[model samples]
Target: MTVPSSGLRSPEARRFLNDRLDWNLLRTFLVIGQEGSLSRAAARLHLSQPAISQALKRLEEQLQVSLVIRRGPRISLSSAGQEVLQIAAELYGTVSRLGPALEEPAETVTGRVHLLSISRIQSRCYDDFLARFHQDYPQVELEVDVLRSSDVISALLQKTASFGLSLCRTPQPRLEQRLVLQQRYAFFCGRRHRLFGRKHLNLADLQSENFVSFTSDQLGGNLSPLTVFRDQQGFTGRIVASSASLDEILRLVDCGFGIGCLPEHIVAADVQAGKMWRLPPGDGVSDVNVYLLWNREQKHTQAEALFLERFEHMLLTTELGERF
Candidate 1:
């Protein structure tokens, strides 16, 4: 491959020069480029600012190029730094693809792991999982992104994410899926609503009530649980408002706009605080099954495997997992 014009002549020459280059120095340089400050990059990499500065200096000496321009408290990438950043990212991707062939011991599975999930799952379910993972695998750098379920699947397919958590599973031959949990949903209303204090309430009783709808990418299309439940119950209530944010849904419900169907975990605190009341059990509302998805074609990194194992263990053995 032809090398870019970053004071480098040929690929073979660059490779020969890079023989003495340290991987840690490259990592430090990339982190500095991302954070744009030695202090911030040091904090992220769990090193002192002076150590970070030394690493950058060593990297510059090895490459024989000025990579960054440092000001009072800020740093900007030089043209050479930008070119090296792109090449370093490509190198990182190549190393990541080596997967289990490069696996070290479980305790030393050190690398970056990219995970994608829906907003609800990230906020409500994976917080504790993330904490435990970080505690056990301190060397592993975890990166997470919250996106829509469809977008999460797309990221997995495009190999942009290592794994994804989604609400629904699609039939793709090239993708593998495992059911993470089955989340039970309940109808909720603000404490001040007419049905808040009502006992023995059922789906029929909510027929004419206004409803707040939260959008989701379901199997068929973009539809809200309220819409599905309404159709299932043959209820004719109108949707007073719609939003994609769970916080907005709660706010709208708390303001007495309308009742909404939400996962039990989401409204648990609200229920305990008496801000929302759960309607009695009914048939229209159904449990949602969440799945973990990954590309079957990609090899699993040791860190990714460890994360999956710990996540599954937490899901099956913990209180949060028991709730499902």
Candidate 2:
């Protein structure tokens, strides 16, 4: 049997991976070890003699553990090889049933799963996603929350949600992540503002204006995206107001409160509806990304697993892979 690499089995202190071990090779190993001959093992498996030998060789290379003693006609297992075979046989028992365990019975899908997001604009995806989730898993319930950027990590850690989405720039050991989209920040002014229809405004144009921003406590950093807004091409702006709520910020921006920094996706619809417009390219703030986060130790509940499965399929098939 092809034993998985492990600190206990290897000469070095490294853990084994599920992908590295080959089950078919282990079956060949078991047969070869039993018959004590390659030709005989090959006959039992109905494989070519060369195939039997190659399988054993690949296993040895992967484990960094020699598994056999070979001569022209005689074959025997090394002591280390014998130990591996015994351990591998036990591991094989579980590996064999893994497929059947997940096959599942055919029935209506039902389960409760929770999801959390960093911003309201991203959470908007859930309105349609949940309606569809219910159609598939009619009895399933999905709870969604929109929290600040920093709270996404905290929510996952505290087990308050099964999935989290946010702008996670650095890796955190406690969580696993999958990239959903890269975000670019944009500047927008209220429809009532004088610059509403103004185009081609340079960084210098924004230098003398006040801006609205996310509070540091909400953004999880010393500086908000305002840093990007204020420093673009050395343009400096005054902070007129700061709050964590995107909806409130957008409304205030609509009410002629102040110019603001926002994700393009967040303001795209409004821009399309002619409620707001983007500033000139070089003067624009940038550098933001959105990621899906979760704790690996606790996998998705049945409902969440199916939701993720469908969501992943949607991304794979659509051109909109970057945003969701």
Prediction RMSDs, each to the true structure: 18.5, 15.9
For candidate 2, give the lDDT. 0.68
Question: Candidate 2 lDDT, tens digit per residue, 193-283?
Answer: 8788887687678777677777652234723454744665575556677776778788878887778878777788899999986775543
| lDDT of each residue in 83-151, candidate 1, tens digit only | 887677566655644653455644676878898877666344567668767876789998988877778
Clashes of 1: 0
Which regions in candidate 1 have their CA more than 4 angstroms from the true location?
A: 1-108, 122-128, 217-219, 222-226, 282-284, 312-324
Candidate 1 TM-score over all chains jointly: 0.59
**Which numbered prediction scores highest in TM-score against the true structure?**
2
Instruction: Kindly give the stretch of ten consecutive residues in candidate 2 with the minimal lDDT sum.
Output: 313-322
Q: After superposition, how far is residue 13 of candidate 1 from its true place, in Å?
A: 70
